[model samples]
Structure formats: C-alpha cells, structure tokens
Target chain A: MSHVGYGCLMAVDREHVLRSAAALLTRRATATMDEVAKAAGISRATLHRQFAGRDALVRALEELGIQECEAALGAARLDDGTAREAVRRLVGEFESAAGLLGFLYTENQLFEGEEQNAGWSRIDARIAALFRRGQESGEFRIDLTPAWLTEALYGLFASGAWAVSEGRVAAKDFQYMIVELLLGGALRREES
Target chain B: MSHVGYGCLMAVDREHVLRSAAALLTRRATATMDEVAKAAGISRATLHRQFAGRDALVRALEELGIQECEAALGAARLDDGTAREAVRRLVGEFESAAGLLGFLYTENQLFEGEEQNAGWSRIDARIAALFRRGQESGEFRIDLTPAWLTEALYGLFASGAWAVSEGRVAAKDFQYMIVELLLGGALRREES
Candidate 1:
C-alpha cells in the first residue's frame, strides 16, 4: 500500500480504538486499561503504544467528544434561519455522540477540585450561544437563561442516553423525544 | 428527659448522619464510611452501629431518598389540581432532596447488574402517572411518553443540582430553572 494509504488506515484504526473504548467505558466506568484493550480487540501493547495510559486514553476520549460536539454544532448551523430549527438540527446531529457524552458527563463529576478539560467550556459557550440567539430572536423564553438552558440540554442528553440504554425508550425515538420536549416542553399549547 | 425523648434524639442523630453521608457522597462518591461519620460529627463506631456497612449505609440513603420523594409527591397534592400546578409544587418540594437524589443517581449507575433498589421504580411510576395525567388533561403534549418525561425529570433535577453546586446557576433559581424549562421549554409563546 502507498504511504498515504497506510496513514489513512492508521487513522481509521485509531478512531476505532477510541470508539470502542468509549462504548466499553460508557457501560463500565471502572474498566481497566487491559480490559479496554481487550474490548477494543487490540493487544495491551498496542493499546499502550496508542495511548500511553488510562489517563491518556481518557484525555483522548475527551478530545474526541469535543470534536464531535464541535462538528455537530457546525453541521447544525447554529447561525441558520430560525433558532428553533437550528436547535432541532443540533439535537439530531448530537444524537450520535450521546453515549460518549454520557460517559464524560459522569466522569466530569470526579473533577471536583481539579481543573476540568478546557474543551468543555468551549462546547458550553457554543451551546449557550445557540440558546442566547433564540432568546434574542424572541424564539425562546427569557425567564430561562441561556446558561440554565444549556445545562438542561446536557442533562437531558445524558438522561436520554441512559433511558435508551435501559430499554425504557426506543433508540429510534431518542432525538424526537428530546427535541420535542426540549423545544415544545411537556405542556400542551392553548390557543390565544 | 423521658425515654421516648431520648429515642427521638437518637432518631434525629441517625437522620443527620444519613443526610451528611448523602451530602458528602454527592460531592465525593468515594467518601469512606469513616469520613461520612466524621462529616456527621459522630464516631465511626456509632456510625457502624447505625449502619452495618457501606452497603447498609447506601441502602439507608436510598430509603431516605425514596421517603423524601414520596413526601414531596404527597405534599404536592398531585391529584388535587391541574397537572401543571402539581408539577410546579412537586419540583418545589423535590428541590430539597436534590443532593440526595444526585448522590443516588450516580450510585445507581454502579449497580450494573445488581437488583436496583425497588424504591426507585415506585417513584418512577408515581412521577410517570403525573405526566400521564397532564396528557389526559390536555395540559401536556401527548407526543412525549410518560416514561421519557419521568426520566427527563430525573435528568433535569440532577443537572440543576450540579449547576447549583458549581455556582453555574444561582441556588435560589433551582426550582424556577427546572420548572420553567421542563414545563415551558426554551421557546417563547407566540400568542398565548
């Protein structure tokens, strides 16, 4: 194979390992590095070479999650026509990252006094900006601040992920369930 | 003091220990039983006498969480009025248990294959019923399932609790933040 093709293959392999680690860790937060490699179908030596250790692997996962969120935000086009439609698109785009996001959400609770991944703040600001746009456009209620709405979005994503995992809700319904309730709420609209 | 008064004092002490454990564990899930006792300002021996072991202590915490949830549901008078009003009251009442709820929320994830504390399913049913009532009353949208709404409530509560703890959102806004978002969504009403 050509050098460029081999490099592409390596990138694909790295992505596979990261995704496998994310899936396994999401199911069992305390899984060891050896177990992570086993789950990823790679040798422990290769796993170590790929990721120096558990901390490095976790950091890589964090990076991957951030990239996914950034990509999803970009694809959703938060600056598009209507903030509501933009949010719908965002949730739809974000659906794929829910499992990885859930793992990171729980992992973050352990960072009490420690410095958190800076990537999180960037993602938060982006999401919050979407809510702010909605508020500015009079598309969203001002009573709920952008910050709180952003936090709520994270919470609901984690919740929806868990619910889907436990068979409490269908996988197919995940995006619709979150988007409708989030954008429309549980309340039925009455005619003015 | 009378023997009954002395017993009452012991009960209060036990309750205090449980609450302290919940608070500490919410902040640090790995807190030791000894640390829990210290946080409660009691001896480890006394803590052991009250709760046999970590499992026993966690079980006691689960019971406390359940009782608080049931109490909140009762105090909210869920069946007496409009589902919207009932949910507001329920969120108001449940606000106090957010710390314990948050701790249990994380703790349960570790249960993996273990039998979940039955108390949780009972609470789930009760909360789901409230959502069902809302839908039946035309006060809530029918698109979202009662089960998903129930799960969303859990997510929002945990999110609000964390946001409050981190000072991301004001402590006083916890109820409003959850209630307004859960009921009204981020979108502003166009006419009504």
Candidate 2:
C-alpha cells in the first residue's frame, strides 16, 4: 500500500481501538489492557504500541471523550434558537457519546490532585455558558446556578446511559428522558 | 460488664466501623480492608471479626444504606402531602446517606449478573412508587416513567454527593440542589 494510504488506515485503526476501549471500560472499569485489545480485535502488542500503558490508554480515552463531546457541542449548535431548544439539540447530539462520557465521568474520580486534561475545563465552560445564557435569558430558573446545572447534566447523561444499558429505559428514549427532565423536570406544567 | 452490655458495645463498634468504611470507600472504592479498619481506628482483626471479608463488609454497607433509605422514605410521609413536598422531605432525609449510596452505586456495577441484594429492589420499588404516585395525582409529567425518574434521582444524588465532596457545590446546599433540580428542573416555572 502507498504510504498515505497506510497512514489513513492507521488513523482508522486508532479510532476503532479507542471506541472499543470506551465500550469495554464503560461496562467494566477494571478491564485489563489485554481485555481492551481483545475487545478491539487487535493484538496486545499493537495496543501497547498505540498506548504505552494503562495511563496512556486512559489518556487517549479522555482525549477521545473530549473530542466527541466537543463535536457534539458543535453539532448541537448551542447558539441556535431558544436556550431550551439548544439544550434539547445538545442532548440529542450527545447521545452517541453517552457511554464514553459515563466511563470518563467515573474514571475522573481517580484523578485525585493530578491535573485534569484541559479539554474538560473547555467543555465544562462551554456547557456552563449555555446554562448561563439560559439563566440570563430568563429561560432557566436563577435559583439553580449554572455550575450546578452543568454538573446535573453530566449526572443525567451518565444515568441515562446506565439506564439504557440495564434495559430500565429504552435507548431510543435516552434524549427525551434527559432533556425533558433536565429542562422541564418531573413536575407537570400548568400550561401543559 | 454484663453480657448484654458487652453485646451493645460491640454493636456500637460495628456501626462505627461501617460508617468509617463507608466514608473511606466513598472517597476510594479500591481502599483495602486494612485501610478501612485504620480509618475506623480499629485493628484488622476486629474489622474481620465484624465483617468476614470485603464482600461481607460491602453487604453490611448495602444493608445500612437500604435501612437508611427506608427510614427516609417512611419519614417523608409519601402518603401525607403533595408529591413535591414529599420529594423535598425525602431529599432532606436522604442527605446523610448520599456518600454511602454513591459508594454502593459504583460498587453495584461489579455485581454483573450476580444476584443484587434483594433490599435494593424493595428500595427501588418504594422510590419508583413515589413517582408513580405523583403521576397518578397529576403532580408529575407523564412523559417520564417512574423507573427513569427513580434512576435519575439516584444519579442526581450521587452527582450532588460528588459535587459536594469536590467543593463544586456548597455542602449545605446538597439537599436543595437535588430537590429543586429533580422536582422543579432548570426552567423558570410560571408560578414561581
């Protein structure tokens, strides 16, 4: 194969490995590197060559999660229409990354005092800014701060992912469950 | 000391050990039993005498969590007031167990196919029933199911616990953050 073709193939291989690792880790946080490579249908040697060790693999996963979240945020068009509509769109766009996000959400607990990847702060700021926009526009309640709302969004997304995994909630309904509950809540609206 | 007095003292020691273990494990799920004993200011021998092993200790924590939840539910007086009021009361009462609940929430992921403690089912049903009661009373939206609502509540509780631990949200506002977000959501209510 041509050098350029080989390079493109390697990029695709890396993407595939990262996704497989996300899926495996999402279900079982304790999965070994061999387990991760096996899930990716690749050799452990190839996996190690790609990621030097568990820390490297995890860092790669964090990078992938951040990229996917950023991509989702971009696709959601957070600046479009009303803040509620933007939130709905964001939840819908983020559905595909729910598993990876859930994995990262729990893995983050292990960071302790270690420096977090800067990508997360960027994503958090963007999301919190969206919440702040809603609050400023009088679309969202002011009593609940944007920071809390952002954190709650993360919690709901992880919960929705787990619910879908356990078959307690339908995968098709993931976006509706999160968006409706986050924006509208469990209370019945007087207008509705 | 009399036999009864000795038994009572042993019971108190066991409770202390369990709470210490819960607090330590809440922060570090991978903490060793020796570490747990150390946190409780007891010897490993005494810890083992109380709890046969890690599984036994975890099972004890689960029981404690379940009992606390049940107590909270009973105190919330689900049948005596408006659904929103009941929810607020429940959140207030459950705050103390948030850390232990969070610990158990992550720990349960390891049970994969192993029978979950039956106590959880009872707790789940009771909580879900609260949502169902709200729905039947026309207090909650019909779009979200009780099961999803229950899962979301659990998610938010864990999220609130973590946020409080990380100092992202004030420790004092834990109940308010969860109660308001879960029942009322982020949107500004027409009446409020």
Candidate 3:
C-alpha cells in the first residue's frame, strides 16, 4: 500500500481505539486510565500518544457522537422520504450508538455549566429543523414544537438504552419500542 | 379539634416535612443531613427522630414517590379520558414530583441487583396497566408495549426537569413538551 493509504488506515485505527475506550469508560465511569487503555487493546504509551489523558479522550468521544449523529442524518435520507420514515430511520441508526448516547446524556446532566461542544447544537438544530419541516408540510400535528420533539427523542433514546441494559426490556425490541412510542403514541388508533 | 384529628394533622405535617427535604436533596445529592433538616424547618433532633439517618430519609422519600404516583394515577382519570388526555394528566402530575423521580431514576440505574424496591414495581404495574387499558379501549396505538411506554415517560420527565433547570427549556412548557413528543413524535403526521 502507498504511504498515504497506510497513514489513512492508521488514523482510522486510532479513531476506532478511541471510540472503544470512550464507550467503556462511559459505561464504567470509575474505570482507571490503564483499564481504558487495555480495553482499547492498545498500550498505555500508544493511548497517550493518541489522546494525552482522560479529558482529551472524552472530548474526542463527544466529537465522535456528533459525527455519528450527522452521519445518521445523512444515511436516514431525511429529504427523500416522508418525515415519519425519516424519523424511523434516524431512531434505527441511533440504536447502534445508544450506549454512547446514554453516557453523554448523563454526563451532560452532571456537567451543565461546561460549554457543550458546538457539534451537538448543530445537530440539534438539524433534527429540530426536520420536525419543523414536517409540521410545515402538514405531515405532523401542530400542537407540539419541533424543539420539544427533539428533546423528547433524546430522552426516550437514553431511557430505552438504560432499560435494555438493566434487562427490563429485550434488546431486540429497542427500536420498535422507541419508534412506536414516539410516533403513534401509546393510544390505540381508531379504525376509519 | 379532637385528639384523633390533631394526631392526623400532625402526621400529615411530618410527611410534608420529609417530602420537602427529599425534594431539596434530590436536586442537590450532596446536601448534608443538617441542611436537609433545615430545609424541612425542623430541628436536627426532630429530624433524626423522624428518620434514623440518611438511609432512612431516602427510604421515606421512595415511599413518598410511590404514594404520589398512586395519587397521580387516581387523579389522572385514566379510565374516563382519551389516552392523550390521560397521558397529559399523568405527565403533568409526574412533573410536580419530577426531582425525586429523577433521583430515583439515576439511583435505579446504578443498582444492578435484583432487589428492586417493591413499591416501584407496584407503581410500574399500575402505570403499565393504564397503557394497556388505553390500547384495549382503542385510545392508543398498539405497537409500543406498555412497559416501554412507562419507561419512556420516566425518562422524559427526568430530561424535561433537567432541561428546565438548565434553562434549555422553559419551565412553563414542561408538560406540553413531554406530552407532545411522547404522543405525536418528532415527525409530522400525515393528514388523513
């Protein structure tokens, strides 16, 4: 392989290691730095070279979350399908990253004063915009604001992930649970 | 008032004091026992007499949450109203005790053991039954399980409370936000 191709592969490998460590530490908040490094399957020196310390590692995780959200939005084909389909796609993609999202949700609650990494705001705006578009297009009900819908989606995502982790709900049912509750609600629809 | 009436009043007052303390401490988890006593407006001795220690205080708080949830279930009039109205009432009442609920929600997450407080299970069953009733009566959609709907309600309450506290969302809109998102979802609904 060319030197440039090898370097690209190396960067991708580093990103994977960082994401694995972040997911582990998020679940096990008390995990020592050494534990995190070992969990990533990289030596302490190599981990340090990739991320100077725990703080740096967390920040990278935050970035990864933002990036994944953006990627999900793209893959969801928000523009091509009905808003309902788009939301289902978004929720489905989000399930893959639910653990990390749950970690970040709790972390944000604990550390409210810190400036949120800007990427979340951008993503929030994008998601909220989708809801607004649905409303404008008469695809959604008028009573709820887009802003609230976005926040509620986040809440349900976090809740579903935690419930699955605690074994209160089955893992396979996560996507179905969130999508149905969010869209059609708990009420039984009347037959026309 | 008669002796029995006086005793009943005193019992009510004592319960109120304990609940107030719980609400305060839930928001600030690290509050001292003295601070809790002061918030309750009772002397440290009286507070200790009512509850043996922090553990006792927490247990009482949990009991209070269970009772309040039962009361809300009764007041929500789940049997009479449309599922949407029932949910709105449920979320509204749940919002009042949201701080304590949030504390318990996070606490339950840390507790990996099988021994959940029985009161929680009772409350969960009652709420889940309400959802099932909605489904049976044709007031709610059937795809989402009653269990996940109940869990999502808890999660949204916590998130809404936190968001309001942090000024991300206005306090006035808490009920509106939770109900709207839980029912209508983030997508625009199609006009029939």
Best by lDDT: 2
lDDT of 3 at B8: 48
> Which 10 successive residues of model 3 chain A have the least lDDT summed?
A4-13
lDDT of 2 by residue, A165-185 (tens): 999999999999999999888
Q: Write the per-residue lDDT of candidate 3 for residues B1-192, one digit (tens) a residue.
A: 467555544543677777778777666655678888888888888888888898778778778888888888888877766767788898887888887888777655544444779988988998888888877877677778888888999999988887777677899999987887777665444433
List TM-scores for all candidates, in order.
0.92, 0.94, 0.79
Best by DockQ: 2
Residues B15-126, candidate 2: write the lDDT tens digits. Answer: 7888899999899888898899999998898888888999999999999999998999899897778888998998999999998998899788877769898888998998
Put the candidates in lDDT order, highest first: 2, 1, 3
lDDT value, candidate 3, whole model: 0.78
For every candidate, what share of the true interface contacts is present?
Answer: 0.82, 0.78, 0.60
lDDT for each residue of candidate 1 in A1-192, tens digit (9 for 90 to 100) = 467555544533899999999999987788888899999898899999888899889989999999999999999999998999999999999999998898898788886788998989999999999999998888888989899989999999999998999899999999999998888888888753
How accurate locally is residue B138 in candidate 1, as Cα lDDT from 0 to 100? Answer: 88
Interface RMSD per candidate (angstroms): 1.2, 0.8, 2.7
Candidate 1 lDDT for residue B37: 88
RMSD of 2: 2.7
Clashing pairs in 3: A139-B188, A139-B189, A140-B188, A140-B189, A187-B139, A187-B140, A187-B141, A188-B139, A188-B140, A188-B141
Per-prediction DockQ, in order?
A: 0.71, 0.79, 0.41
